[model samples]
Target: MNRRTDETRPARSKGREEALDHFVATVAKIDEVLGAIKAANDEHYGTHPDEVHWGHAGDAGRVLAGLKEVLDIIEGE
Candidate 1:
């Protein structure tokens, strides 16, 4: 009889791979959102101070927080 060791084990399950893909895609989207927020801040930094004052930065912060939550969920899995 022959037995397999840890190094000879099969790859991860399909469900796990799918979950990782979903997590990676979500992270990429979060990065895009961050880039957009940074661009908005830069574009309006001097042009419209009122835009940042009117909760644009806060909105961006909220988005970041949501992204963090999603990442945490993925990590927990």
Candidate 2:
């Protein structure tokens, strides 16, 4: 005989859905930063590549790094 048990049950709560929504929002924000970085890098590379340095890229890099960490946390959980 085959029967289902509690061990094979699925989560029935709004918490998971809420978490997914939050993750999607966070990812969207990260995408926005990526877009900004691409735009800034393109403009700088085309007009002032020499002026682009660690100081200029630092903020965007930091944001991307933070987003990566958040994504890792979500995936880990």
Candidate 2 residue lDDT tens string, 1-77: 99877655555346677789999999899889889868866676354666677876786578678878977997995
Off by over 4 Å in 2: 1-12, 45-77
Q: How do all models score by TM-score?
A: 0.46, 0.47
| Model 1: pairs clashing at backbone N, Cα or C within 3 Å | none
lDDT of 1 by residue, 1-77 (tens): 79767664545466688899999999899889889868866776445654456476776678679878977996994
Native-referenced Cα lDDT, model 1:
0.74
RMSD of each: 6.3, 6.6
- The total of clashing pairs for model 1 equals 0
Q: lDDT for every model? A: 0.74, 0.74
Cα deviation of 67, candidate 2, in Å: 9.9
